[model samples]
Target: MAVEHNEAVVLRAIKDLVIEPIPVPDLKDNEVLLQMGSVGICGSDIMYWQRGGNSRFRLEAPMIIGHEGSGTVVKVGSKVKTLKIGDRVAIEPGTPCRRCHQCKQGAYNLCPDITFCATPPDHGNICRYYKHAEDFCFKLPDHVTLDEGALMEPLSVAIYACRRGEVTLGSKLLICGAGPVGMLYMMAGKVAGASQVLITDIDDNRLEMAKSCGANHTINVNGRDKLEVASEIEALMGGQPEVTIECSSVDYSYDLAINATRQGGCLVAVGRPSGRTLLPLDVALRKQVDIKGIFRYVNCYPAALEMLSTGKINVKSLITHHFTFNETLRAFETAISRDAKAVKVIIHCDQ
Candidate 1:
C-alpha cells in the first residue's frame, strides 16, 4: 500500500505559515517525490520575510518558499533507476528541459525553460514532500549529512563563481563579505588550489568566522573609508589581488573590489546590490581589468557534492545556527539581529 503524505507549508500570502494535510502529487514517469528534511534559509528567503515580497517575486498568491534544501527519496517513478526509496539526496531546484540546446551542450544551467523549485508563483521546496524530476536530484554519500546535502546548493554557487573567476593553483583571491556565499567561495578557492584567500567584512565576528572556514587573512571594512580599507587589504595580502569576488550587496563594495584588485586583474560580483550604482568603467578600462557578473549558479552541484563527500571541502563550520520549522519567523528575525553569530542558519524539518 502507498504511504499517505501530508505536510506543513509556509505560505507567503497569510503573512504566516500553515500546517495542513496535502495530497501528494503523483510522480511522473521521470519524477520522484522527496521528503525534505533540512533547508537553509537563503538570503532571498529573508528578503521575502523582511519585505513581505522580494520585488516582483512577491507572494501575492500563497507560495511555498525554500530553495537551499535536501531530503530523502520516498518514491521513484517507473523510469527512475539511479535512485530508490530512502536514498538521501540533494534536490536541484531547477529542472531544465533536456531537449534544449543548452542541456545538450552540458550548459543546462543556461536553459531558459527551467522549472525551478521556488521562484514566485511556482511552489518551492519548503513543503514536506516535493516532486522533482529524478535526473535532477543527486544522491549523497552515507558519510555526508543531510545538512551538507542542503549546503550543496550554495556550495554549487561557490563552484560556479570559482570556475567563472578562473581560479587556479597559486592564484591570489580576494572575497568581500563574510556571509555564507563568501565563505563557500573561500572553501572553493582552496579546493581549486588558490595560494591565498583573503576575506573582508564590516563585521569582525563574521571575519573571525571566515578565518575558521579557511580564509588566510581577514579585513574589517567597518569604520574605515573605502581607500583606507582597500589599503589595509593590500597590506594584508601583500599587494592588490589578482582576483576580487564581491559577495556583499552594497554598491560601494563593488568599488572597493575594483580598487583592491591589481591592474589587468578580474573582478566578479557575486552579490546583488539593492539597486544599480555607477560603474567604474574608466578605472576598469584604464587598468585593463575585467569586470564580470554572476547570476545564481550553473552546472556545479555534482562537483560540489563530490567535493563534500571526498573531504576536499567541509562547509559545516558555517552552520552556526539552527531553527525548527515552527521557528521560521524567529529565524528570520535572528538572521537580521546585529548580535546574531551565524554564518549559515539551517532549519530542520524532520525535527
Candidate 2:
C-alpha cells in the first residue's frame, strides 16, 4: 500500500498551516513514489502561506504547499523504466497536457492545461511520500545534494530569463534585484559567456552575494532614485547594456530596465508584482528594445541539472537557512521576512 499515511505541510487558509496526515496516492503505471528529502521555500510559497496567493493564483481550497522539492524514490510503478526505487531526483512541479499544441511545439511551459503543484486544486509534493510521473523527476548526480536538487526550480527561471535575453559571448548585461533569482541570473549570464554583468538591488548583502556569484559590478540602490541608479549602472557597464533582466517587481525596476538597455537590446521581465504596474513604454519603443516576459520555464530542468552536476553553478551558498520538516512554519516565516541576509531557506524533509 506504499506505506500507510503521508504527513504533509498543508495550508488551510491565510496564515494557517498544519501538518496533517493524508493518504499516499496509489501509483500510476508510469509514476514513481518519492520520500521528500528537501524542499526550498520560494517567494510564491511565502505568499501562499501569508495571503493565500502570489498575484495571478488565488487559493480557494486547502492544499499541500510546496513546489520546489527533491526526494528519494521509495517505489516505482510497474511501467516506470527510467527510475527505480532508491533513485534521488528533483521534482518538476508542472505537468502539462502532453497532447496540447504548446507541448508539441516544445513550449510546454505555455500549456494552458498544466497542473502545477501547490497552485490551488493541485496537491504539492511536501509530504513524506508522494507519487509523480517518472518523466517529471530528474535524477540527481552523486555530488548534487537534495537541497541543490530542490533549487533546480528557481535555477530554471534564471536559465529561461537568460535565454530570452539572448545573453551570449561578450554580452554586456544589467540585472535588477539581487534576490535568489537575480543571483542565479548573474551566474547564468556568466555561463552564457557574458563578458560584463552588473546587478543592482536595494540590499547591500544581496549585492555582495551577487558579486560572489559572478556579477562584475554590484550596485546598491538603497537610497538612490531610479534614474540615478540607471545612470550608475550604465557607468558600471561602461556603456548601455546589451541585455537587461528585471528580476525584481519593484515599481522603478521596470523603468530602469527599459532605460538602461541599449538600442535594439532585449529586456526580460521575470518577476510578478502584485498589482498593475506602469512602464516606460515610450523609451523602449524609441530604442526598439525587445521586451519579453518569462513565465516559469520549458525544457530547462535537464540543462539546470547538468550545470549543477558540472559545478558550473554553485547554489550551495544561496542556502542560508535550513529547518526540519517539523519547523516548516518557521522556515516560511524566515523566507517571508525579507531579511536581506537570508538568501534561501530550505526545509529538510528527511527526518
TM values, all candidates:
0.94, 0.97
Candidate 2: how many backbone clashes?
0
188-261: candidate 2 lDDT, tens digit per residue: 88999899999988888778888888789988877677778778878888898999999888878888889889
Given candidate 2, what's the lDDT at residue 87? 92
Q: TM-score: which candidate is best?
A: 2
- Tens digits of per-residue lDDT, candidate 1, 250-316, equal 8778888888788988888787776667767788888888988876677788899889999999988
lDDT scores in order? 0.82, 0.89
Among all windows of 10 consecutive residues in model 1, the one with the lowest summed lDDT is 12-21
Colliding pairs, model 1: none
TM-score between candidate 2 and the true structure: 0.97
